[model samples]
Target: MNMLHTQLLQLKPDDIIVEPSVTPLLAGRYRTKRRRQTLHTHKQFDDWVTVSGVQKRRQRSCKVCALLRGDRNKSYHTTFFCEDCSHGEAKCFLYPKARREYNGKRVVLQRPGKVGRRKKTRRELLQDGGAADDEEDD
Candidate 1:
């Protein structure tokens, strides 16, 4: 039930309807899986309402910690929260079914190649002639 709620809160109305398609033969009537969206979540408050999105972390503070123990300095920081829900509340939530969905698009961002480089592989270092570009007429 908790997982269901977290997903609902993360909803954003896209310009195009991706969930369902009516392309006759090509499109599916229903969404097979949730697409990994890159959300730029930022930490609003220190402990109560923190956010994390598109950031890679090997170990995140467990979500269950908040459920077992109240949010009072338990340090079970959540990734994202609905602005409507957090407003005017004493604390964001006590035992929220905290779940994390990482943005897979991060793999492209973390590629070893330098930024602004082309998608294709670099040209061959050695040309047909044996003399490399660096060794030209110096």
Candidate 2:
């Protein structure tokens, strides 16, 4: 409780706090036991309302959920992406099985080389118009 107060105060002016009211829209799977859950129950702490409001910033948009669900029908600006994603490469989100599509995409430059999607062969190992091992056998 006390730590939350300090964290909220330290937030950037542009940052938004994802409370219970806003968490559903941000990430529906967030655990209810999280500290932000306490913010939803405000009647008991009437005095702290003003203090909390000043410190906590509301989320302007749910970047995490948007990237995971990819429900944006209209053209929307992207803000987040997996570090290993590339412009033309296909990839699933960190929890691909849980979602139908990736929440976001990224250029290869932004991603780490080691985190790329599984590949059958390295680009350097590929031979152009040459006899491969299987071809020689045939």
Candidate 3:
């Protein structure tokens, strides 16, 4: 737990990327454990909610969910915000058996977040003085 905290604190905001999930609305903002079932929990101590997936899953800062909340009309075990994902255990149950839909829509390891989420580099941070230290705390 301490090491996770240290690593978490060492992370920079630019290290994380925010994106919309294809299955944008599946579960709620928070999840709990019961009967040995897997569920999403608040991973970040600050709980910024970069991303989250259902049990037998996966996340980004959560503009995807934020964007979909008002539009969804139905949901399933992994429905687009179905909100009754009790059928989930360890295996995936994204509705209609479209397993491929559960995958992340985009990933760019060379960069963080969106294509241009961060325009500054470590050298640039250093140029900004204490700003770099503050960034490390995110």
Candidate 4:
């Protein structure tokens, strides 16, 4: 068995390690596993949203369930249902499918180009500091 596994087996059920020394190794393993699961779930959800049918349907229907059922009594045509299975619009905001649709139309807003100040050229860098012989050769 690995050192960590052996050490873990040696500990009692109720035993707690007070020292920070050993906790980090165990914590690192836990964090790695947690991160892997999180990435897996993210990729799974992304793939589901990007599917051909899902993408087309999401443009017109509610992204939570893709259902068209509406309540006429409340006169809420576009009111979302926030149930246990699907947390309605709140949860939908986390997925891109829900954000792209608008009243049976796909809202296509042009994304602005890359932002932020431009990188300084070698000449500009030399001006900021004393020009070095090595920099001039480059």
Model 1 collision count? 0
TM-score of each: 0.18, 0.17, 0.17, 0.18
Local error of candidate 4 at residue 8 (angstroms): 20
Ranking by lDDT: 1, 3, 4, 2
Tell me the whole-model lDDT of each prediction, alpha carbons only.
0.43, 0.38, 0.42, 0.42
For residues 1-138, what per-residue lDDT tens digits would candidate 3 score against the true structure? 999999999999999999986765546545544575554332222112234443333222242333222233223323322223424442222333222211244433322233225578988878887877779999
Model 4: residues with Cα > 4 Å off, grouped in runs: 1-36, 39-56, 60-89, 92-114, 122-138
What tens-digit string does per-residue lDDT give for candidate 2 at 1-138? 999999989999679765666423446566455542221111111122235448532222223334434345422222222334323443212222222223254433242234335655655356532548658778
lDDT string, candidate 1, 21-127, tens digits: 56655457564767666442333434332248554423334334443343344555444343434456533432244333222122322323332445443444334
Query: How high is the lDDT of residue 130 in model 1?
Result: 43
Worst 10 residues of 3 by lDDT: 41-50
Listed per candidate, the RMSD to the true structure in angstroms reads 22.3, 25.1, 27.6, 18.0
Clashes of 4: 0
Q: How far in Å is the alpha carbon of 63 misplaced in model 2? A: 1.4
Tens-digit lDDT track of model 4 for 46-110: 22135754452232233433332223211112223323334444433123233343343454664
Worst 10 residues of 1 by lDDT: 101-110
